[model samples]
Target: MVEAAAPAASVVETVAETEPPATASAPAVVASPAPSAPAPVARPAAVEKPVKPKPEARLYRSRTLGQWIKRVVLLAVGAIAAAAILILAARGVTTLPGVPEFLERYPGEYHLPATAEPGFPWWAQWTHFLNFFLIVLIIRSGYQVRTQQKPPAFWTPKRGGKKISINLWLHQSLDILWLANGLIFVVLLFASGHWMRIVPTSWEVFPNALSALLQYMTLDWPVENGWVNYNSLQQLMYFLVVFIAAPLAAITGVRMSEFWPKNAKTLNRIYPVEAARALHFPTMLFFVLFILIHVFLVFSTGALRNLNHMFGGTDVVNWVGFWLFAAAIAITAAAWYAARPIVLAPIAKLFGQVSSR
Candidate 1:
């Protein structure tokens, strides 16, 4: 029994020696990642530049009073120079071959028909005065209507239509009276057989007119016997004023006026308002030219005689006609001065309503 126990002990010891001794392994090492650089700071987006506004455009440049004066002086100088040149050239042309003979042949006039009466009648004289008054007022009001951007007073028709400036109302009113006067003059002219005086009856008038024009250019005016007969040029001018220009002015004025049918699209298209506007201004300019030329000729040729014929119904050159003319001028000047808003407003109120706007 003791020998078996000893062997068991030995076996146990041998097993313990064969087994490896218990040991602690070193702690596992882990490399931490290096600290990353701070993320780059984001830059602010580039700021956009602000845009500038555009400027308003102008139609006409402003002119000083001095500049306007300078312009007028320049125009006057140019006109004087042109007139001098024209006069010299015309005088030279008279010395050309056959010119004298031509002048002699035409003589700037032709005899009127036997039916045409001589001398100005009382009705004719009165009509002439009426024409003068009405035309002056018409021209003034027309110009005012054209240029007045801000009217002092406006007129609305009693029957209700588009409102017009007081100036325009005056212009239209004057136009009506002038038209009636013109119609009366025409009727009288025909009834008295005076149409033959202005209306050309011969083809020879053209050559005679040319001769008269040349004579006028040469500063050697044609013979004046307007009481009995007018030169070919005067006859032609009178005819144009009485027939062509007057009718044209009336037609264009009516086209532009409120009297025109607003809804008549076909007529509107056929005769556009734009066309009427264009023609109307030109006609007014023509009338103005005619007036200036007529006045100049009347005064330059024989002031007293012409004034007597038209104003006094006499062929004699006397102060009576001159005084009458002076009175007519005074009346015209008064009428012109009184054509303001203060005077026109009450008159407008009689026909319609007047307003500031």
Candidate 2:
């Protein structure tokens, strides 16, 4: 037993000798740091694009030439339709009760007074021509004076009371001529016993005038015998134009003119310039209408004979009066064209000092 114990103890002693010895404190431990997170990337900030501004809208829409043409066509068609309707309506009116009888009884005219003279005199023809020339110039200058924004030339009188526009000067000058011509025409008319033809003698004129109007409207015009005696409608129109309209025009014109007495406060109050202005334009419009109607009637009803009565002082239908009328129209047109500042300034300088300012 001893031998076996001795062998086991020797083996333990050898293993104990081969084994490493432990110290009083264990060796200090060394730990490695953990891996850090990756640095954040810095990208360029997003760039903003500029926005475009919108355009402003127009006030009035532009129209094509075609649109204007369409409008003009519509107006012309409308006028034609209206005329057709009026003619149809007038024809229909003739069929009404008592209308036909009334038209037949009157026959559009009444007998002239015993003192009335037949046919136009040579003086009447001359006066008519003078009136036409003066009136044309008056209307042209008057319109220019009214509508001109800037005067081309101004006139200062030799005595120099006030500065007046060239157009106004022309208008005033023409007015004087017209007044003189009118006065002469009036004197001649009475002296020649022609006033009895135009002045109404009886109340039969009213019915005759109505009958004449109806006849004209129905396109069945009455017989025109202006040389022997004017129709009642014609007589009334002539009287109104010569008496009522002429006097009214003259009074209103005088009130508006520089010749009026500015110091006469009472007269000015009684006949205000405003009233004169109001009446003057309407009177001009009336004259325009009368002239247009008269010219149209002259051309439509016996053009040659009427032209001869006025222009040739005879009732013969010939080209002599027509040629003379054409020449008169040419002369009038030349006068109109020559009424500009360029031509008028020279004439104006003869009487007054002309200036642009």
Best by TM-score: 1
Q: Which lDDT tens digits does candidate 2 get at residues 215-329?
A: 8888999999988888999999999998999889889988888789999999999889999999998998898889899999999999999998889888788988888888888
In order of listing, the candidates' clash counts read 0, 0
lDDT of 2 at 89: 88
Candidate 1 per-residue lDDT over residues 71-102, each given as its tens digit = 89999999999988998999999899999999
Best lDDT among the predictions, by candidate number? 1
Considering only N, C-alpha and C atoms within 3 Å, which residue pairs clash in candidate 2? none
Clash pairs, candidate 1, are none
Q: What's the lDDT for all of these models?
A: 0.91, 0.88
Residue 138 displacement (Å), model 1: 1.3
Question: In model 1, what is the error at residue 208, expressed in angstroms?
Answer: 0.6
Off by over 4 Å in 1: 1-62
Measured against the true structure, the TM-scores of the candidates, in listed sequence, are: 0.81, 0.79
Single out the weakest 10-residue window by summed lDDT for candidate 1.
Answer: 55-64
Q: Model 1 has how many clashing residue pairs?
A: 0
